[model samples]
Target: MPEKVIIRSIISPHQRESFTQFIPLSPDMTREIGRTVKEIFDSLGGAALLKSSRDVYVKPNGIDAKAYCYTRPEVVRAVIEYWQSAGARQVYLMENSTQANYTRVVFEVNGYRDICRDTGAIPLYLDEEKTIGFEFTGRKSIYDGDPRGYDRSHCEMPVTVTEKLIRRRDENLYVNVPKLKTHSMAGVTLGIKNQWGFPVHTSRGHDHNYNLPYKLTDVLSLLRPDVTLIEGIEGTVYGHYPVTALADRCVKPFRVLIGSLNVAAADLAGAKILGLDRADVAHLDQAIKRNLTGGVTGLDDIELEGDFSTLENIDILGDKPSSGKYPADLFDFFPWDVKVLKGKELACREGCVNNPLTLLQVLFHDHNGRGGWTLVMGKGFDPDEIDEIQGRVLVAGHCAIEEVAERLVKRLGKKKVYLSGECNDLAATAEAMFHLMKVNPVSFLPRRRGAAVLAFLMARLHGSKSRVPNPLSHLIKMV
Candidate 1:
């Protein structure tokens, strides 16, 4: 039988202290987290598992640590101090954020760099270092594809190891330290979300997977760590960006530190603490479906320390569970369903709007030898730019280009103007309706479909026209 999952909670009356002083964290707050880690780990099993560890990797959830969206430095520092006492030879805290600015600056802004230096733990950027790929084996369920039969995928892909934190033949313990926050895509990001930092810089595109919460959890299901610690002191209730925090003053300040042996259990518990619905999160559901947590129901064995009732009072000011009917049965997701794509490819008329799934899909496929597509953007009634190109083009979605269909049929003389993205169904339905009527249908452009539409348009303009089958054709054609 698998070892029993363990979770320990540390509740301090002081945790509820407010940050009225305009600092990111307080000394009292830091000490509280350290005490929590020490208490929980000590009670669950013991510190002996980590006592002789020579190297430690404190993976902090950077989520681009712009401001309120990431794991606070103080929380990580507190953990570092605890690890030092545990006899860890070297402790390294690391993350790779997505902001265009320098990682060092971003780290400093969030006070992570200073915390690392002060605590004698080295700060590293996963993106900048030279990565060595290691083979890993893991499994995932194909609920959307084959039912009644479970499936597995070996995570044996080459993974880049952190060289700076490497120790000689000594048992390595990972302390997953992530900030508590609501995710628009994953539902909630905690320990599992922090593991995305382990891959090489090239694999960066996997994050765009719309079903990232699940995909990420799948990845972690194979490489789960020894423990997880979450910094829930002051988390962004809004999506995972600092700019959004200021523009949208929605964040929850929960003074609780969570520790768990099971990553999913920790996230599920963390979600409740943040007052989020675990079922609503795509990744948590996926992870559970794939048996990533041993079983979500198995969480009954873990201990809960703080007031479970307090979770009810957490006011979610930003990202919250979608009101749409969440899939109760993980197997309910079907093969043809868009959600099965891992990440979705949403088409828009212009490239302005960013669709996390489609963006991630393109990046993953491109990096992993799937296919490379061009980005297109344009408006209706515009002269066809494909005329200048020698290859074929895919109009990912319809835009109000003056008789674009007519133009594709007229000037360009191409029949394969692939329509994908948001309004493809509606546009295709409208086209079918017009085909039934035997006349050109009015161009129906949906809002937020601009990104797909623009990709199509630009592909036409910049000679992105190549006669390749649309990735979403099997799904879209059925519609």
Candidate 2:
């Protein structure tokens, strides 16, 4: 007999006049979250699981410090407090934020530090720790073979984690906490996709292109969470990153929490709530086919506790009439003067094509549209088209730079050409585009200027070489 999988979701019974005014850290909200977390924990046998081990490691989606992009600190506090009440000896909150952004800075910006100080949960910044390489075997590439002649069957990647998490895996409990959001690359970012942050920043781009789904699944194979809690109080659309300009249209306040011991089941339920089918999210689909879903073969297999019907479908970019096939379509939401040119041969939707475009959306919205610029990505651009390009050209990704950097420099001159060489390297891309568009990085935080400056300074003092927009880097380059 297969193990039974039950996914329990709790919807806040309280009614509010305006969903837009929902405050995540409000006293009322915190109490509600605490109650919901305890109910879910009791329902999912979390206490029984905790009986075997007193140590707990909680991994939250600290992808970025941006609002609505990461798991709310309030939700994490509730989870930590619940675990403590259930006789947990120690709870360690760990995360290595998105590439280019340091975990220390992210923790400060997102209030994880405050949560740790208050809840007595030790904060673990994975990036600051040493890493060891772990090999994942018997994994098959979900996409075509890499152009660089590398086999995806066996992958050995470095991960920044304590020895307790690896050596004493069975002795401690691992909880996965992720925010509900739509991803331009993986369709939906849930429990399975949340583990993407485990890999070191440098190794992130290795299979980030077409084989991202396979890479994500391979990570799951190694670091499968014992319990998954999907925080859906304020879900985001139009990709995982927060879009302040599109907050009205993009952010969805579902006021619900989805939990399960089986990560895949929880993610499947999350996908449904996001108005996506099983096949829509490639990572979830692949995990199901690989039998990593804890015997959950289909939606029928899950015994759901909450009413999914009452939950409205989130409006993601993919749901648009244009299907969001190209990065250019994202610009339609804003009146930004930007041109995204993809390779005629093939544009990797998972990385090169969408990553830069997503960042551009944030920049355009926050800064009120930079001047007209052309972004060249992927490979195989026509010479005539390259010559006709106007203004500064941002040559993004390794393929684009190798293919058209020389031509762009020759036709448009060296001063007109900017290079952000890496597959979905947001830090380098942001810096390159910031220079090309002449946007000040400090200007991004007009209201929280002091906090932002202090965070950056502290991260620097701590010897963090993170690629997040650095004021000093900008000052030196622009000078």
Candidate 3:
């Protein structure tokens, strides 16, 4: 029989605290927090998992830390210090930031560098590190209906993993500390969802089979977190990143969830804490279908030991069950399912949008109702309507390209209509829209502009080797 999948929780005494107070976390708080973690860790037999381990790998959820979207460095520091005191040979803090941006930027931008220095830990940017690949047998379901998750091509092709991780022995443990947040694609991001960071991001391109849930299932089966720690000190409601505490959609749910030996179970408890159904999340549902929880049954099956009542009905990003999803009001202008195309049909999936709305949302943030950009996605377009007064029409998918690209471009002129050649690719499409809006997307990022400026000045003044120079800017404002 599989070992029992046990999970527990602790209501942070400071769940009522504000996010802005930057006072140093006191030693008393640290010790108590460490005690809380160690209690849970010991219960999970995490120390035995660490015995004679080649290295201690801490995978904390973040591109960089902001208010509620990342694991608290204090928590990570506590875990590392505990293990170090327990005679860990070496400890390494590792992450691969989203968008393939600079990992060091997050380390510096989020005070992780300081955490590393204080804790005597080293950092690893998985994106820049050496890697190796292994074949994934797609016998597992890789898609919605497809019982087999990946295709023969995916199975035949070697799935690459970081060399540092691939080379480690099975007993060398992986500690997964993920932030608590609702995801747009996966419903809620906790333990299982957080594992997405482990894979090389480029594998997500059109070729590698776009089945995120199944892909994660295969990866988790091979190497999932030995212990899952859900960071709820602070969290976001709808989506991750480019979010502000109050302005975007962030919330503080002063709670921490710990699970022993099962990532899915930990996520199950975390999902309920976020007031989300286990069925609503694709990956969670898929895990059930695959029976990948190491014999742990459903959400009810997991043994819960904590102040469960405290987690009920916490206000998230949206409201009700999805306090974590973005507010629908942001789409009042281009309401989802309202046909903007001439005659194209758009299939609506749960927790997904058709058009590339990233640029629109960002534009709205900077210029809410004033921006003159109108997006018409899907197929079927009336030439007369398309020719009428307009700023730019964003052809969102391949269907639009097939149906309207030529006529629309001929009438509106090449500069007027932007075609996102691929279907439903938000990043590429949003970038195209950014060009139409006369704004560089990079500058919109918090500290990227400052960094670019520094890199430029460095090259100009010091004959720098690289294209751009570095800037001395404050990314970790709170830190």
Candidate 4:
């Protein structure tokens, strides 16, 4: 059995009134958050648990360039403050952002840099050194890597990890600060998902078939963090929701911090706060099977504090929308699922006029049932060539919003005009035309690879709408 995990909660709303009277934290939520965090650690037997004489490494989530989409800067500040108070030496804040974005950038821009500077801890990048390969002989699992590339095992593979971070002197402690977010591939992302940083040189752009949750836990088991702090102050139901654009979706005042010795247990407790099933996450499932942190089967192992009823205000994870699909749910047709963009006389005034064409290409590839695809452009072709193909038309892009809606309404019945854009509000506007106000990722890519496929599919499914002048040729360079 793994050690019992201690989980704590402090729920509140992100209101100006609730944030009154606090220290360097500025917001009242900070003081409550600090207290709540300290309470959990105290119940777990205190910071003395990390008095071993070794180098302590801290890893915070840094997958995106967005600030609010990540862990709150105050949470890291509070943790560092508490750790310094506990008499820790040589604190290193580390992360390997898949996007190659800087953790310091996120921290500095989000107010964490000052906290670290004032606290006297240095920041380290995880991708800076050579790594040693480690094998997982435990069990056959999901995300099996092909050993043929490096003469390795199906389940076992070489992993590049920093040597300096491997062994702590004696009093070393590793703290994992992770943000809670919903993943499109994995059901949810949390502390375990943060472990993707461990790989010394792997770029985030590399695609893997299985969910990252399992692999993350496997990596963490090797690192064996002394404790984990999951910051839930603000999280997204939709994965990769940029901090600046969508922090308000966080309906509940999750002014709480959850901590635990058992990473799995802590994750379980955190997932509960979000109303997600532990089993729903493949990483947590794999962790349980491999017996990492004593295999927590449920939330029963956790000791909760504060009024968790505040969580009742949280929306169901499935019911949440990411970017697109307000009146329509994007999740309904996620990843190979059918999506019907039923519209009449659709027209593209801006963005990718060739978007419907590109979507048609995608549909063709889909029909071929082949996985890998590439859309390459060669020498210039005549604009008249645009008449060669067909599909239902729709205006999708940032520019399409200016006046395309009214024009599109004149051609396609008002009900058929759905605005798709990178902006949810714009898509929501289209939904409003249909009499439902909801956010959606409606912006369509014109002639781009993904857009090509979507356009192709629409053509195959709905037949080509009337072919116009194909102004997309002129705009091709803009893409």
Best by lDDT: 2
Tens digits of lDDT, candidate 3, 1-479? 33333333443355324544323455565566787777777777755667456477888886543445467777888778867876678888877654424455556556676788888888765555444555554344336455424432242111223343454436466788887776655567788877666655444322222355666666666566767777665555555543342332345444454555678778776676566766667677777777887766565566655544333453432355434423222223332322344344542221113235533554444433224555665455666776673666666655557877787778777766766543344444545545544444444344445554443343345421111111211121110
Q: TM-scores of the models, in the given order? A: 0.58, 0.87, 0.74, 0.59
The best candidate by TM-score is 2
Q: Give per-residue CA lDDT, model 4, range 22-51, as digits (tens).
A: 113346777877777777767765667666
Report lDDT per candidate.
0.48, 0.72, 0.55, 0.47
Could you arrange the candidates by lDDT from highest to lowest? 2, 3, 1, 4
What value of lDDT does candidate 4 attain over all alpha carbons?
0.47
Q: What tens-digit string does per-residue lDDT give for candidate 1 at 198-298?
A: 65433333223333454476456546767787777766543443232132234455566777777777877777655655556666776776777755543
What are the per-model C-alpha RMSD values against the true structure? 13.8, 4.2, 6.9, 14.9
Model 4 Cα shift for residue 24 (angstroms): 11
Compose the digit string of candidate 2's lDDT tens values, residues 368-391. Answer: 557588988999889888778988
Error of 2 at 254 (Å): 0.8
lDDT score of residue 280 within candidate 4: 64
Off by over 4 Å in 1: 1-22, 99-102, 133-170, 211-214, 242-248, 298-301, 307-479
